[model samples]
Target: MDRITVLLADDNLIVRSGVRALLSRDEGLEVVGEAGDLESLIALAEELAPQVIVTDIRMPPTFNDEGIEGAKIVRKRSPGTGVVVLSQYDDPEYAVGLLTEGASGYAYLLKERIGDGGQLSRAIREVAGGGSMLDPEIVSALVSPAKDSSGLNAEQQRLLLQVGEGKAVKAIAAVTGQTPGAVDRAIGELFLVLARDASVGGKDALRRLRSLHTAILEREEQGETLSRMLPSKLAAKLRADPTASSRTERLTVTVVMSDVRGYSGIAERSDPGALAQQLNAHRQQMNAAVLSEDGTVMQYVGDAVMAVFGAPDPQPDHAERAVRTSLRMHELQRALDAEWQKEGLEPFGMGIGLSTGLVAAALLGSAERVEYTLVGDTVNLSQRLQDLARPAGTTVASESTVTAAGDRWQWEALGDHLVKGRDTPVAAYRLTTDTTRTEPTPSREEATR
Candidate 1:
């Protein structure tokens, strides 16, 4: 790690020297310049171009908001320079005001707490690395009065506070007993929600969001994109119950099982490169369709895509959503197949199954590779129904799914068939509506495009 260049600014000479002495003690920090007033601070910032500027919240002739004004000017002039504001009071408004331009590369700490362990050093390091931190005293003061007004529950507020205090994703996860991926997803969602609030100030919200995004993206020491593994809602659930992770709950949900028909034959006959491309495109289309309807993709096993609607986060219309997703998936596959054919590639045919009933859902396996698993008749029956779609491009649903989905679809009763797992026969329904209508998607290409 390169040493962080620091510039100290304060009206009092004693305070400036003390800060410089404290920060210089760390080999990672280098005190390059000092300023006693706002004018000098701005001049030295331009002259030295320090990586970080540690200054009092109020200073100079007026002693009003010169520190903040100077910091903003410095930020505008030097794009990546971090500003650390030291205040004598516990007011959250000062910290709030400092973050008006943007949240990236900023920190606010009470001057009295500078001697409390390594608070000053931590703030400097956090701000230097494009992270924001607020004093705990300031956060506590703000969280209490706005709890009921903002509609944020206790957990959300706690998470927000942790973010504001400059805790890294893994740090927050450790404190909350949640996975780091879950914390990263929750923070992104929280900031977007907060950014839309008229009272929160859009610029400030965006700043917080931008800073958080930067922090989370760089949290992994090995530079891994860890947060992309799970659905946002699933990650939120992981954060919601970090302690009760492995507990199973009997919940009613809509399960979707899909597989590429004749995948074995296609893989054996087609070129390796072409088959890989086709499978990749198929998965992308399927994932888009499932996520568009707020469904969590359970996993992709070979050419099979399994998705679930409802569990990890409750959706009242899980069955309906599942049906809609199945329809969309079929349509999306058609569009992808058309494109693939135009490029002289083999087309993929998919068979889907939907079943709505009670299933036991739980966070299973271990932390290294945690997974959301569903077990019960619903899951088994759904797989059986998928196998029943012999000709492909068709979605078969269970009777319970048809009932829960109401009269939304033109259902063709497939009658009763004995599923592999059960002794008794199960009545099934096939969605007779044309699945290849080609629903207009927002974009022509995937993210990799």
Candidate 2:
């Protein structure tokens, strides 16, 4: 007979209004209060002690990761309360992070799906009943080949899979007929298996847990969830030194970069809201394609995406996977164009490039400012390839990538090209759908006009 109390946190008034309107139609749900930023959300969560706190990823002030941080605060302060995170984007890393505390009473939904009242209500009820929910898109992103070898055990993997589907640990336990204690123990064991120590007690344990929680939550909140924050080069080196007690492994990877064609022109011509919607659509399509091919999207840079293969987890076929993903991304762009045309919008295209090489992959920055990213010539080359894609009218790749790809893809040698910073001229290639044809040569006028 009692209504489910809900605290809504979102910087956007319209989104909050829309969510409130949708939930209002449901008799079992009640909106307790609304907060426009992380601080207010945290304070309200503490004060209201709502059954569930639903929040958006972006909020006021820094707008970087307020929602996720607020979620952490709520989890720490009100263990009895549930948290549901909503975002326009599907970032699996965030879901993983939120569910890391055992995937009970946690949910992540794509904002676009708010219109689906039934789905939204189901998610709310699921989390309220100590269940988890994640957008299908987020699940796909987290299961990529690059993440396949993250060394997660059966229990952790199962937890992730269940959480991805928005099923809570309690629900999972009920299905498996495992006791709640057993499920909780399994999650704790998983944290240990991930090289995170759970032995330390008191303030140290709490601090570590908070740190880990923040790391995972911020990723989801900032749309950077796919990548794991690793220690910085200096810290890693220090940890790896024989004199130091800490030990960690380093990984090599291939980086892929994709940028929208004529993005600046589009942004300049379109309203901010329209441009954002367009970019969001483009990112959704690109993310789906990339995840389907088993690659991790590291970050979104304005109109571009930085993705990686074989760092968080190494695969012998990482280079090949990255190449295949680039090809598929081209197809995705075309598909998106058709969708745009149907909606009476102008079609825009995407350019993607990939490069493979060694890099020190790890979480970089201070404890308060850490981010997981790859650093090396390979990353730089990938960006350069994205830039080179313009005049060629297709994705381009460095010679190293071509060699790595072998005969699987059709590539035409563009000859040794000069790239900034490197003394030696790097051989570049124009990626083509057809391997039989020689590389096409276009005049300056043709390329420009």
Model 1 lDDT tens row, 45-107:
986667789999778779898998999999987656888999997866677677665566778
Query: What TM-score fits each model?
Result: 0.51, 0.49
The reply for model 1, stretches above 4 Å from the true place, is 1-228, 240-246, 435-449
lDDT of 2 at 71: 90
Q: Give each model's whole-structure lDDT.
A: 0.76, 0.67
* Model 2: colliding residue pairs: 94-220, 131-168, 132-166, 132-167, 132-168, 133-166, 145-294, 230-363
lDDT of 2 by residue, 1-449 (tens): 54677899999999899999999999888887999998899888865567789998888888877898889888886564677899876755566556665555677888888666478788787677555566777666654322343566676777655543435455668988998568757756654554442232223333333333343333332222112222222333333462431323355666889988887777677765445556656776677777776677787778788888885667778877887787777777787778778876666777777788888765556645556667778888888777778642377887667666655666666778778777778777777653222443342224324
- Alpha carbon lDDT of residue 383, candidate 2? 87
Highest-scoring model, lDDT: 1
Best by the TM-score measure: 1
Clashing pairs in 1: 103-207
**For each candidate, how many residue pairs have backbone atoms clashing (under 3 Å)?**
1, 8
